[model samples]
Target: MEANKFLDAKGLACPMPIVKTRKAMNDLLSGQILEIHATDKGAKNDLTAWAKSGGHELVKHEEENGILKFWIIKG
Candidate 1:
């Protein structure tokens, strides 16, 4: 899906991906989408929970070639 901003967190681990995602989301307006590319396997669950807790929408997510992609709409 289309996104307003893209955050590449590839090669990072754990909290780093979520941390970067949080920072990147700050640059977007409400309802805008932030696309994140992370190699951390834990990012899927971390981001999903983070988005839900922050009231943002986790639009979709998938994995390919060990890369995890997520689309989050700013709340």
Candidate 2:
């Protein structure tokens, strides 16, 4: 999936990835995508929940080489 913006949250833990993601998403318009790369294992659940609660769309997600990649569309 393509993204209008990218956030490198690799190596960040806990709330940091979500924190940065929230900030990045703030700059996007509705329907635009934000791609995030994170190494935190908890980010999968964290981001999924956050996106849903925030009314954003969790478009796609996958893992590769211990890295978690998420594609979220702003709602």
The per-candidate count of clashes, in order, stands at 0, 0
Clashing pairs in 2: none
Q: Which structure among the candidates has the greatest lDDT?
A: 2
Candidate 1 colliding pairs? none
lDDT of 1 at 1: 89
lDDT of candidate 2 at residue 27, scale 0 to 100: 99
Cα lDDT computed for each candidate against the true fold: 0.93, 0.97
**Reference-based lDDT, residue 23, model 2:** 99
| TM-scores, all models, native as reference | 0.97, 0.98
Worst 10 residues of 1 by lDDT: 13-22
Give model 2's TM-score versus the native structure: 0.98
Off by over 4 Å in 1: none
